[model samples]
Target: MIGVSVIGAGFWARQMHLPALAQLPGVRITSVVATSPESAQRAAAPYDEAQALTDIAEAAADPDTHVLDIVAPPDVHLPAVEIAAAHGKHAICIKPLARDLDEADRMLEAVDEAGTRLFYAENVPFIPALQEARQLVDAGDIGTVFRVKACEGIGEPHSPWFFDPDRSGGGAILDMAVHSLEFCRFFAKAPITAVYAEAGTFVHHDRTTAEDTAVLTLRFANGVIGQCEDSWSLQGAMDSRFEVFGTEGRILVDNLHRQPLQVVNARAGWSYPMPIAGLVADGHLAMLGHFLDCLRSGAPSLSDGHVGRDVLAVVDAAYRSVASGRREEIKETTR
Candidate 1:
């Protein structure tokens, strides 16, 4: 059995990761670390065998733990990885990998030096609909890929930290666009050359200093262009969609308001929360299972440190472009 310790017990950790881990075979939750002892206890309450601690070091030092799953904020990512490295444990970190490219590199160096595997828990590409889209592109149904469009619009985030630029690194552009951007690179199979972006806090100006909505256009080295739109102002349910246009045909995955099944309640009007690709998606289960499988078989992750770092580079360039009011060249980083 692969015993794992979770570093953070926040929303994603409490709702998604733990539930997914519970359903997986031959894996157990050994420890849970939270900001406070009470919160940790609350997080670990579902698992009677699990221990709750306030410090990551306590979980990292656990002899029964084989892997560390980090779902903390952007800033603490590298430090969590360092603690795992010190104890010779494999790590799975949720994106955005780090606050910036430099910290990402340092985290990569730490994992490599410790001879431990690192997985970036990005679920966009693993989505069944997106995976089908990828297969179509691979089978040449799309002919020569040229342009892609991905968008995500949602109401305010559940956590307050998402609004703080310092804690989240940025606002919608950083938290929401990262998924679409990574999947764009995955399909393009090319490095991003430059990024041009425009962002503003038009909707929630008083709530956050960071931009609540933004759009980014990416130019890939292979001549592929990608457009991404992210927002925190949309009302009601979440809306996310992707479209890939190629020389021959086009592929579209719409999960926003157009789901297979829609339920409308007398009190709640129109609700489409059943088949979302984002929250509570089946992709989360697949992602966690893949991580455990890789841990057991000693295989490399599809979303490794290098891929995570490259995604951050695009984010870095996007923010720079937002400041300079001009397209910024991305300094590509490779594994």
Candidate 2:
């Protein structure tokens, strides 16, 4: 079994990742590390075999830990990564890899220097509805794809750290737009050239100076334009959807709304809701399972730390665009 130590004990760690990790075969939940012993134990309570540790250094030094699964807050990601590299352990880091590009580069560099893999644990690509849309586009169901759009909006996040600029990066755009950007990049199948964005603190002014809602226009190398929208101030249902348009047709995938499970295949001429597992659970399960399989097979994952860094480049530009009130150029990065 590939022994894994999880480096967080927060909501995502408990509700999403830990449960998914338990369900994966050939993976052992060796430890759960948190800022405190109590938090670690609480997060690991469901797993009988998981030991609780209060610090990443202690968990990284443990010989049984072959991999460090990092689901910590954005600010702590770099430290956990450095520790994992120091211990020569592979890692699985969640999305928005770092608060910024410079930090993300360090995270990527450390793992690369150690010759250890850091799989970017982004579940958006593995979402069942989005995957179905991509397959149809690839199979020529949507011929010569040209335009794409992805949006995710929900009421304020559960944690307060999310609204803090220093800890969680740039609020809704960074936290939620990262998801839309991933799927948009997936469908475009090309490098993003430029980003035009607009965002402001429309709500939660009392909570943060950060933007609660944002929109991005992504220009892809393949001549396709993609749109990404994110909001923490959304007052309605948690609306998330993906739209892929091509010369021949369009494919629409909707998740978390009145017709949440609907996948409208323009080529097949169908718009029907199909029952599946819950969105959050299914996404984490597929992504973590894919990473576990890659661990044993020695295969490169679809979203490596470099890919996360690349996405951050867009995010970096988007924030700049928001500030400058002009379209920002995306600096080329090593992806």
lDDT of all predictions, in order shown?
0.86, 0.87
Measured by TM-score, how close is model 2 to the native structure?
A: 0.93
Residue 172 lDDT in model 2? 89
Per-residue lDDT tens digits for candidate 2, residues 1-335, read 88899999998898788888888888889999998899999988889889999989888998888999999899989989999999999989988799999999999889989989889988989988778788899999979999999989876787888989999987988999999999899999999999999998887999999898999999999899999989988753366788999999998887664344544344543233535445342477988888888888998888888889999999999999998999999988965
Error of 2 at 72 (Å): 1.2
Scored by lDDT, the top model is 2
- Candidate 1 residue-wise lDDT, 1-335, digit = tens: 88889888999898788878878999889988999888889888998588998888889898999999998898889999999998999889998998888889999999989999889988888787788899999999989999988888877777888888888888888788988898788788888999999999987888889988899999999999999998887655566888899999999888554466665555664556565544445378888898898888878778877888888999999999999999999985755
Per-residue error at 199 for model 2, in Å?
Answer: 0.2
Q: In candidate 2, which residue ranges exceed 4 Å CA deviation?
A: 257-276, 279-282
What is the TM-score of each predicted model, taking all chains together? 0.93, 0.93
Kindly give the stretch of ten consecutive residues in candidate 2 with the minimal lDDT sum. 263-272
Model 1: lDDT of residue 25 = 94
Give stretches of model 1 more than 4 Å off. Answer: 257-271, 275-282
